[model samples]
Target: MKKKYLIIGAGPTGLGAAHRLRELGADDLLVLERHGHAGGLSASFKDDKGFTWDIGGHVVFSHYEYFDALLDSLLGDERLEHQRESWVRSCSTWLPYPFQNNIRHLPPQARWECVEGLLPGNRPEAAPADFGQWIEGVFGTGIAKYFMNPYNFKVWATPLELMQFGWIGERVSVVDLRRVLRNIILERDDVSWGPNNTFKFPLHGGTGEIFRRLAARLDGFIEYGQEVAAIDASARTVTTKAGLTVEYETLLNTAPLDILASRWLADRDQTMVEAADRLTHNSVYVAGVGLDIQREAERNPRCWMYFPEQDSPFYRVTNFHNYSPNNVARPGRQLAFMCETSYSAHKPEKLDELMDQTIAGLVNTSLLDAARAADVLTRWETAVDYGYPVPCLERDGALKAIQPRLEALGIFSRGRFGGWKYEVGNMDHSVMQGVEWADRMISGTPETTYRWE
Candidate 1:
């Protein structure tokens, strides 16, 4: 088979590209998806018990107008808007999200420690070199010790020193001594600091509904269950594991860049393999625990909570039922908890025992009652091999070496893992990367979201 454009992995990026290509009057494009379904990491599932759950904690918030417009067009009135009520669990108490800003909620001793560390010259004077140092320099020893250090390690599953600080743009809420003190003195709840303060959710299905509706617009263009096996870049051809080969004038890869470079490419060299080796990522295990709401105290207004302490194996847990009433079988009468635990070589976890560990964690963190363990209606879980694309010290340098070389061969890699950029790997950014790539391909418009430099 031959096509003008070929895209691998029909996730947000591939679907977005196909949608835009068609909109721009280009029909000679095809998207290859390994799974029989679409949505990639954003996909949702319904257990036999009728509870819907996403892969992890995914909230629909955008940094792009085009992405917002696309979502508006796709879901229309089928979506629900939500005010983010996020919190942090530390010192066996719940504090507002961005723990540093709400140190007042902590016990007097812990709160004073946070403030004392932020005083005049307690923090490091020199410019920080890594994420670990940056956390200390910016948040001070107290905040880092209480929240940032442990929470980040649990989420990233990587040593903070090995990771770089460039990726912490809007993702982290950076606070200073004055801001910290003022919030405490003024007794203010500084919860509305981030871009996802107000977000949207699908009223019926989980977060995947947005992508599912988008994929439907480009029906015949996407070929499901066709995982790419090898790509001869020089020949501009791709071979799938199902023994089908397709030649293309141009290719867009929405899969992991490391795998594309090290495992897929037929003519890859030493530099490409070495560059690929430097691109590190952490795997995630998402456990969805659901049960009937037995008591009034079982419901909470908070959307999600972070676990910085070792009491919970999971770093984050989303009150999935709060996002949409339709998430559970009985709506307001049921509860759905989606917990995420990340693991990597730096922080190994017993995947086999994580579900049980997660349940125990929920109880330990006070989300679940110890006696209600037997009442769980469903325990749905999935382990994703490529969860977060780690912003390692060598990531930028590796991308600089690999991306340009691939682009020279009429191949473009974009999206979350494809671009290997955690900073712009959100759903909106991933889709726009593909849309921009399509624009660049068809009309010579420059791509902006995932710049290797």
Candidate 2:
């Protein structure tokens, strides 16, 4: 082997970098994956019935043309595109997705109150410093209290007030008061406003399969099940969990930077380990339910919905079977996918109790019916300890405090957790990070998405 570029964690990021290197006719690339597969937490599995589901919901919505082109080249025509009809289920009603901005669905009393808060005459003459303040700036206090604030705390596992509003980009909705009021008076849903209105999903395998296929294509370059245990920056060498060492000119790590930092610290002493402890990530428990519903995937083409009310342990539910017919067993087949949830530490719910409660909540919410149901087929979990990178008030301070010093030591950390910018850290962003890293390393191209883009 040519002792080439060492790519850690064969997730989307690593695989993307390797594939890009090969596509560019570059050589001496080695990808080390911790798990036995290409996809990390974004991996997928099949039930005995051959139904495919991602570790969690991994929808494909990219900002880069390269990402879309890469995916199309992989899956080709066997892809499914869906228009998301998402809404917030609260106050015993289904408010449209831009819930705060679309308060026309709310009852008369609530609507008038929201209007007074947001209506042009009473606009606040200030800028928002926190997520809560941003909500008030965008939707006003009345609407913020009703959905934006609590729903955010439930989803992000951090209080809105504790988070800086800088990360909020196209991820949120800022309503035009006049347009909102006009649409509301006309009894319009206006749900088709966001960037995810039309999104693409894999037709056969789960979202993870895209990376799996990418790995298979780059067979000679990637080594699965090879976990990176340590990195010696002085000599530019990487040691695997299994004691195998490889020397590289430059390394791109897709593993959590904190984890990689810990391993690098372990190669030294306790002082570095103490500093590494400041990095925080939320653990997520995803419960995948396989149910026996009568409706075919076509009838319920609706992808997923959010339930922020007190009745459900799951903050969000993906109609997995509906997302892709291949996600569940066919009509005569045995296993049919039901729902999937992302449970974080903020609203920690017991797995057993929460699952049962979730099923009951499904019945109550007219999702899973009591009368027509098959025995609960499968209930397995995919727990990710480093799911969400908490955007705490101190996150920027902590990163600036630690990351630059690490970077100074010849460590180029970049990935979902590596860069710690959730706004762009989806599969696409992760891949782009790797691409940019490799490009910068090889050709000295501008790596915009690494820190800023």
Candidate 3:
């Protein structure tokens, strides 16, 4: 069978394209998803013990009005708004999120180190060459050594020196030195920071419900359980794993660009192949721990916490039950936590021992009391192979070489990994990438987010 537009992967990007195409009066379009269901990495699952968990820690926060309108239309009353109460676990004390901004929470020696390093004329005047240098230049040795260094290593699974700056944007908060000193001098907390300061979640299902409902709106358009095996770009044809060959005038690929370049493209040049090979990504281990009883009062209010120290195997832990009551089967009778531990070739993890390590980490961090360790009701674990796209020093070069080459062949690769842009890879951006791509194809509107310019 053939179609005018063939979108691969029913994730946000593909769904966005599908929705926009329908609105633009395009009929000969189809979406092919590898999984039996849609949502891609944003999907959720319910464990036997009646606890729901997302692929990792995902929340609904948007940077676009269209995305807000689409979500509101889909999950209206099912959405639950949350006041993001995030914290960082450091030196046996809970420091507010954006660890650099709240130096007062640290011990006497640590606080002094951070403050002294931040004193005038301490940092270098020149621009930082890499993420490590950027951290040292912006935050000084104390915040870099104490939190940014270790925490970033855990999260990125790549050496800081190998990564470039400029992708941070609003993801990482810049410190206000005067405010930090004032807070330390006044004995106050500077807790509010970052884009996720306030977000939303599904009241009944996990984060997946939004995407599932989105997929439902375009029910007959998606063909599930069919992975794209290969794409003959020159011939404008795609062959799925199920042996279905579909031809299209334009192809919007939402799968990883590396996979597209190195695996799927039948006539890939060595330059494009090697450029794709340079792309790096980390894997995540999501562990869902369901407790027999509700969390203690203090813990109940804490939405999520970060772990930078080596005492914990997981980098971040989300108080899932605190996000929404429907996360657990029994509501007030049960509590849930979703822990994310990242790993890669740079930082390896013993998957066999991950569960035990995560459990021990929970107890070590005081997230779970030692006495109630046995009260753990569910231990569900899932591994996502493509967690975060690393912005290595070579990322821009690779994207420059790869994206243009694919686009030249009428293949628009856009999405989280598909576009290989972490800065605009959020849910809103990913969907808008698709939306803009459809607009580009239908009405000749120039693509914004995915364009190199």
Candidate 4:
């Protein structure tokens, strides 16, 4: 097959690029997807018991107007608006989300420690060199020791010192000293701090509906169940696992960069192997537990919750049923929770026991009552090999060398793992990466958001 543009992976990025090409009146493009369906990591699943679960806790939020308009055009009135009601489980207490602003929920002694460390006398002189240092410098020793360090470890599956902090951007909420003090004094909860404060969700078909709809518009352009087995950069061709060959003038890859380097480009460039070896990421275990019961009144309307303690294996759990009633077979009669746990070489896991551990975690963290554990209807578990692109100390240097070489070969790798940029790895960012890559190819527009440097 010969095409003007060939895209690998039918995720948000590929779909976004295909959508843009259609909008530009360009029809000579082919989108090849490994899986039968679209959405990649953004895809949602319905378990045997009829409960919907996102790959993880994926809430619909954005930082781009294009993404916003796209959502409006695609979802229309099917999008359900939500006011985020998230919380943190610590010391058997449910502190409001943004734990830094709600220290009043902590014990008096713990509260005092957090407040005293924020005092002027305890201020540090120099800037932070690593993530751990940044945490301590910004949140002080108490918050770092109590919450930030352990919670981050559970999420990132890497030591803080081994990771860089620049990728945090808007993902993390910086502590506001005055707001913290005032909230503590006035007994107020400051839960409104992140871009996801007000968000939206699909009213049906889970989050995957958004991408599936986008893919639907492309009609016969998408070739599903055709995995790219190899790529010959010199010939500008892609070979599928089915032995089909497709030729392209420009290639947009949304596949993981490490896989692309080692599998696709290894014979072409030996340097890609070394560059891929240095790129680090963690694997994730997403456990979706469906219960045969109504929503518990105590946790009603709760969107998601975080667990920082050792009693649970999961770092975060989303009340998936709260996001959309259609997620369950019978809206008010069933409930669902999706638990997320990450593991890497730095933090190995006993994969065989992860499902059991996740269930125990739900019980341990009070999301599921121990007495009602027997009422669990279905348990679905899936693993993603590339959960998060680790912001290791050497990541930027690796990307700096690897990206330009691929781009020189007429390949634009721009997506979550393709760009290997977690700061801009949300749904909006991933789609925009594809859209921008198309713009750059068509009109020589510079990719401002996902820069190679």
Candidate 5:
């Protein structure tokens, strides 16, 4: 006689939802994931050399105290806390991250060139109609020309002007003129200017370990690697890719609503299916490249590097090994690096070409020395996809209409692609969004993660 809940996707979001249900003393709740293992985009892998690598670039940073408490309880004192040492590789110089914060590294000639772009007339300040306008508005012509424009093109595979800026919260730093001038004059680093000045990682496993640990406490309550194919919401029954049908009293869907609506409600309700069609998604590729370098970043650990140059196929490169000693192969062996790129569905790319381009970028950016290319043991992984919500002008209007309709039907769709609000769509926001939704369901409280802020 207990109320039943059917949860989909065993990623962090789904795991959070399931954990909350157990805490609320709820029975008849089930969690299902399509991957053979959990973790979704945040999974990890080990190689023959006992080295670990994450699916994409993932870091643990939380804004809420409750989310922090949940992770502390789960991760315990063994968490590998990392001081975020991130930087931007602009042209031949390794500028301190948040490029605008530090410009002293550039030579006088380069400084003048950067200054040239900073003139008042060049500062784009017309309220930012798109992502391009947003970048120019925020950093001004100086940093945008040097980094934002070209780097964003490779990263998102779209014009910055065509994209929307609502999603760029802690992702990029907004410029400050007087502060930038002071930093360059003082010749100091301003890496801590962003929201995530410090982050945490698991001691043993990669980011994936957090979700795995959470699942362990939940008992054998998860159905792994099983995809949700269809749902008869009217009958309160759900069907899986393997043809298992289960009934539920209410449904918590964290999968892409388009997939949910198309496969489940397409035949049943034509409107739900059509509303989903308005959503847009961009594909993400994380390339794990193992290089044989004479001086491995191992000698000096740096958290990550950002690419704003066209030379690199990826817009971001996280020193996967630097996150933790466990992330790399045996130190005596060779070192490795990983890069990430987000692509549009309308613009697909071939892996071979991308790898070749990436290698070329390493040479141009001086990250990879061709002289030492012989010693480098290289491997490429395009294993994961799905990143960066493509925010066309119509995105906001479409989501506004679609979300309220679903909430009215006793369904809560939330997550990276679930609610599709990029402003607060990082790992911290995504997991907390799920937990808040679970709280709402348990106590009849309000949920902001689902509601557009």
Candidate 6:
């Protein structure tokens, strides 16, 4: 097969590129998806029991007008808007989402410790070199000890010192001594600190519905169940595991850049291979626990909660039923908890033991009662090999070395794992990366969302 453009992995990035390419009057493009279905990490599943769950905690919020317009065009009235009600589980109590800003909710002793650590002379004077030091320098010892350290470790499954602080842009709510004290004194919750304060959800399916509808419009442009096994960059050709080979003038790779460089690329050299080795990522296990809503207490308004302590094996759990009533078997009559636990070489977890551990964790963290364990209607779990693209100390350097070399061969890698940038790796950013890549390819528009430099 021959084509003008060939895209690997029909997730948001690939689909976005294909959709935009068609919109721009380019029809000679094809998207290859390994899975029979689309949506990639944003995908959702409906269990046999009729409960719907996303791969993890995914909320539809965007920073791009194009993404908003795309979502509006795709979902229309089939989506639900939601006010974010996020919280933190710490000190045997629930505090508002930004734990530092709501230190007043903590017991007096813990609250005092947090405030005391933020005092004028307590924090370090020098600029921090790594995420671990940055957490301490910015949040102080108390806040880091109580929330930032443990919660980040649980989420990233990487040693904080090995990671860089550059990715914390809007993802983390950075607070200072005055802001922390004022919020406590003013009795403010300070819940609205990030971009996802107000978000949208699909009314029927899970988060995947947005991508599903978008993919539907592309139709024949996408070929499912085709996993690219090898790529001859010099010849601009791709070979899939199913024994099909396609030659293209240009290629867009939405697969992991490390794999594309180390395992797939036929003419990769020592520099590309070494750079790929420096790129690291953690795996994630998502457990969807569902049950009949037996009591009024199960109908909480909070959307999700973070677990920073050892009581919960999961770092985060989303009240899936709250996102949309249709998520459960019975609308507004059942509960679905989508829990996420990340694991990596730095923080190894027994994948086999995680479900039981998660259930026990839910009970320990008070989301589930000990007696209701037997009443669980569904305990569905799925594990993804590439979860979060870690912003390691060597990440930027690795990308600088690898991306330019790939682009020189008429191959462009963009998306979450493809770009290997967690800072701009949200659904909106991922899609825009593809859209921008398409624009750059067809009209010579420069790419902005992702730049290796």
TM-score of each: 0.99, 0.91, 0.98, 0.97, 0.92, 0.99
Candidate 3, position 217, lDDT = 83
What's the TM for model 3? Answer: 0.98
Error of 5 at 449 (Å): 3.2
- Shift of residue 145 alpha carbon in model 6, Å: 0.2
On a 0 to 100 scale, what is the lDDT of residue 111 in model 5?
68
Per-model clash counts, in order, read 0, 0, 0, 0, 5, 0
lDDT of 2 by residue, 37-128 (tens): 88887788876645666776678888899999999999999888888867677776777687865778887877877788886656565887
Worst 10 residues of 6 by lDDT: 173-182
lDDT of each: 0.93, 0.72, 0.90, 0.88, 0.73, 0.93
Query: Which candidate, 5 or 6, has the higher TM-score?
Result: 6
lDDT of 6 by residue, 69-124 (tens): 99999988989999999999999999998888898999998898888889889999
Which structure is stronger by lDDT: 3 or 5? Answer: 3
Predicted candidate 1 versus true structure: per-residue lDDT over 101-171, tens digit per residue: 99999999899888888888899989899999999999888899899999999999999999999899999
CA shift of 417, model 3, Å: 0.4
lDDT of 3 by residue, 30-88 (tens): 99999999898889999998899998888889988988999999988878998888899
The alpha-carbon deviation from the true structure for residue 344 of candidate 3, after best TM-score superposition, in angstroms, is: 0.6
Q: Could you tell me the lDDT of residue 351 within candidate 5?
A: 63
Task: Estimate the overall C-alpha local distance difference test score of candidate 1.
Answer: 0.93
Clashing pairs in 1: none
Question: In model 2, where is the ten-residue run with the lowest total lDDT?
Answer: 331-340
| Better model by lDDT: candidate 1 vs candidate 4 | 1
Candidate 1: count the clashes: 0
